[model samples]
Target: MTHIDSATAGPVSGAVRGDGLDARLVVERGSFRLDVALTAAPGDVVALLGPNGAGKTTALRALAGLTPLTGGHLRLDGDSLDRTPPESRPVGVVFQDYLLFPHLSALDNVAFGPRCQGASKADARAQAAQWLDRMGLADHAGARPRRLSGGQAQRVALARALATRPRLLLLDEPLAALDARTRLDVRAQLRRHLTEFEAVAVLVTHDPLDAMVLADRLVVIEHGRIVQEGAPSDIARHPRTDYIAQLVGLNLYKGRAEGHAVRLDAGPAITTTEDLTGPAFVAFPPGAVTLYRDRPTGSSARNLWRCEVAGLETHGDQIRADLTGELPLAADLTTVAAAELDLQPGATVWATVKAAQTHAYPA
Candidate 1:
């Protein structure tokens, strides 16, 4: 639960005159190799998002100097940290578990960083008190980790990390330890804290909502490589990968485009509003799809497919049907509409999506 301050180490060489993070992280582990180039300005919060075994954590560990880079370089606020040891890098890490010392009070936990940085005991305690106050936990300074609530403990951990005055902040699933209700409140608090941070912050998480809410930009990794990187809104609107489309609740398909029609790789052609050629991607939300018991007579939908209900599940207040047949996709409808259509496993259904509902972009 104790962390050594980077300030205790001598100055490193190769200090440049940059302002923020510039890293080309490359780490190889047997068959797995991660190569991702990342850059961010001061005050920017970037999220590393990926599924399990996708190298999100590996990238984070490399930045924190916990994992040695097999290639590439890491620079933060102008200093090259590629050769810096974990304790000598000007970085702060807020781990998933918070990792507060059980026997120490909240004040001592936050003071640990400054104390290691060569501050006097009184000065470190005073600095820790100020950080605890900024985190709105001044009253809990005397309490042990066991006495603090989940949200409070998270704040203490964040305060501990920030007390080091690090140029680069690394957070690994900071909200994953909390319950749903606690996560909502703590996420907002963390967002505010990140906004007030003057340096660069990098967060690693699998939750799309967390990445969207906390990060200014998103870097999505898959198979140890960056498949996509952009603003959350852009990524959500034009997901380039199936994993991203599913993460954003859209059904995606790749196809060859000709004007408004796209010939999908799955053997069906879908109508879209865009008029582009060559390879492209088509994406539509589940709610944009309408289901019919039988082929609707004289329907105006440009894209229609003969599908069978593969499965059904409750999604919020609606029924989400997983369909497979001529075109595999997902459809969300009201529970009443699902009952009216007699939706169930193996039920035959016709799915229709208007051209205007689908978004198409170059692959």
Candidate 2:
């Protein structure tokens, strides 16, 4: 629960630190291509966040040198590593499934890295023991990978990666193997360990909560490209694309701005207080949307859209209504209000939002 600086703390995100990771990976196959640029500073944890098939794994593989890059540069601490092989690069990777050797004991699994790096058996085992102890797995050192629990195996994988003394750490869906119950605990432990790591670390995950909790900065990728990159809070507050907006649970629209009104590309105009020009984005919380059975006569709300309820679902204590028509948006209402309005799928409703509730920013 220690507080880490929430600034835009990555190489491509904000200001670049001289001694950090600077990479651009491009891979071209027969039909699909991936081109991603990433940067992070020492002591910074960056998460590659996106939906499936968004090239998160491809970028991670390129960074770990497991996949060859068709173009672009890879640098760590001012040293170029574009041509380095996977085994030769000063990098460590923890795969989604942990990828531990089933036959190897936890101690030996961790020791294998240092041993491969030319350390003596005794030295390697000693370092491995220390790492296990740091990971709170000292007593489980003799357990085989199959005998270890999901969280324990994850710690072992992380310990093995760190045992090599890597300058850059790459984790591909590090917690994807664990169940929901274990993921929470393991995520916390991983966060603490990552905070202690002085080297640059990049983790790939499709879970927004995981990315927000484990990383200081998030680089959201879609279709083999970076769509947005910034501090987690900033990204959450002002998502640029529909994918990002959906991930953050905000209603977003793109439009052309004139004074306080934005004419959306999809034929809906939203009124806001922002004095922006040219292309812009308008976003508001689902909770800010008010659902009415009939259009209000004296309501002060400026933005009103006649929408049909396409779907309804319970979200915690609130009911989420998915609407379509003039403006496609999501609205959150209390269970009591939903019952009073007799809300259901295919029901017609009027949605309105106060101008002050809508946030407009340059797109």
- Candidate closest to the true structure, highest TM-score: 1
**Residue 1 error, candidate 1, Å:** 21
TM-score of candidate 1 on Cα atoms, chains taken together: 0.94
Q: For residues 41-76, what per-residue lDDT tens digits would candidate 2 score against the true structure? A: 788899888777778888888888877888877888
Q: Model 1 residue 211 lDDT?
A: 97
RMSD of each: 5.5, 4.5
| Pairs of residues at least 3 apart in sequence or in different chains that clash in candidate 1 | none
Ten contiguous residues with the weakest lDDT in model 2: 1-10
Worst 10 residues of 1 by lDDT: 1-10
Cα-based lDDT at residue 153, candidate 2: 96
In order, candidate lDDTs are: 0.89, 0.88
Per-residue error (Å), model 2, residue 230:
1.3
- What is the per-residue lDDT of model 1 for residues 146-202, given as tens digits with 9 covering 90 to 100? 999999999999999999999999999999989999999999999999999998899
Tell me how far the alpha carbon of residue 289 in candidate 2 is from the true structure, in angstroms, after superposition.
1.2
lDDT of 2 at 86: 87
State in Å the error of residue 199, model 2: 0.9
